[model samples]
Target: MTSSPDTQPIVVGIDPDPTQWLALAWAVDEATRRRLPLRLAHAREAPPSKYRTAELTPAWETWDEALRTLGTRALEQVEAFVRDRRPEVEVSVLLVEGDAASVLRGQA
Candidate 1:
């Protein structure tokens, strides 16, 4: 794995799934070993409603809040995971409103 120095922090795009954490583990390991900061980013955009034709969607605000809540929970879980492994490693989190790919790219 390529190591980032102190100047550039290693960024990791964390998903909503708490059970899936291999990527986070690798990112934390690399950051601690390379002595760089770790960034945990999760995008928060309401997913497309499958019931558009039936007009059976929840309130717009409610859906948006749900997405943000999920993103926040995911970030917290990953942060705890990182802290548990290496307490000394620096870690930051970003919960942005956009697509996952775009959010991560913007972090760069």
Candidate 2:
């Protein structure tokens, strides 16, 4: 029987590195075989802004927006891959702000 989205989804921590999509491929295969939904989670943490007494620097919002943009791109890329590979499988994306490990742990 197929599982619903509310059921235990096959969670995979998506890597920003395109070369490291093997894990995501495996997760998609497993989720497809098990007839479960796939949750692709991408986590990004912005660098700490250094306060310079007399230097012009972008605002915190800039940094946050950049991180979110990159994270969203990464998730979209993988989500497309998974969908193309297995159109029958339900795919979901999660763009989160935090350390990868901590955010993925919360996904579990």
Candidate 3:
């Protein structure tokens, strides 16, 4: 039986790392098989860095842009993976703006 959004089992706690993609993909497949919902959670906070007061330059901007572009590309890869492998899975993407592990743990 298909589950409603409110009643569906939610597969949550996905990390924004390439290594975690397999687990996320599996979760989506499992959710599809069980007729549940899949939640893809990602954190948007800047990564912990030791040098916070460093001066910014044009090169720094370019590097930041590259990183942002890479992240977007990586997320698209995840979307493509789910769409291709678990087309029937009901999925929701959440972009939380804080420590990912902490936020996800609280959600669970």
Candidate 4:
């Protein structure tokens, strides 16, 4: 089937983890084969367990900083990989806030 360049065939959800990158790579290959655009979406999620609790000196700041670093690195890696491997696939990056479902629904 023919596809439109303006329409993305796959929307990849990226998180603060390496697994998301693997999924993105797979989606890129699939979109390329289908001749469709690839959209990258990154979301920031709070961990289930509190990684940092407020203390005399405010330890939450440390936890927040660490999570931010992880998320930033993950996004950067995804962007670089997409640019290098699928430059012709029409890639777009999205920065989203909140949980995955909420952000995705809002985007939709």
Top candidate (lDDT): 2
lDDT of 1 by residue, 10-106 (tens): 8999977767888889999999888888889998864565634335455666777788888889889889989999888889899998888888888
Query: Can you list the residue pairs that collide in candidate 3?
Result: none
Q: What's the ranking of the predictions by lDDT, best on top?
A: 2, 1, 4, 3
Candidate 2 residue lDDT tens string, 1-108: 357546888899998788999999999999988999989998887554465223434566676788899889999899989988999888889998788898888988
TM-score of 2: 0.83
Local distance difference test, candidate 2: 0.84
- As for TM-score, the candidate ahead, 2 or 4, is 2
My TM-score estimates for the predictions, one after another, are: 0.80, 0.83, 0.64, 0.62
Q: Candidate 4 lDDT, tens digit per residue, 1-108?
A: 345655644788886566646787898888788887776776767655554344523555665667677767877888788778877776767765578888767655
The alpha-carbon deviation from the true structure for residue 19 of candidate 2, after best TM-score superposition, in angstroms, is: 0.7
Candidate 4 overall lDDT versus native? 0.70
Cα lDDT, all candidates: 0.82, 0.84, 0.65, 0.70
Model 4, C-alpha of 9: deviation from truth (Å): 5.0
Candidates sorted on TM-score, descending: 2, 1, 3, 4
Give the RMSD in angstroms, all C-alphas superposed, for model 4. Answer: 4.6
Cα error, residue 21 of model 2, in Å, equals 0.2
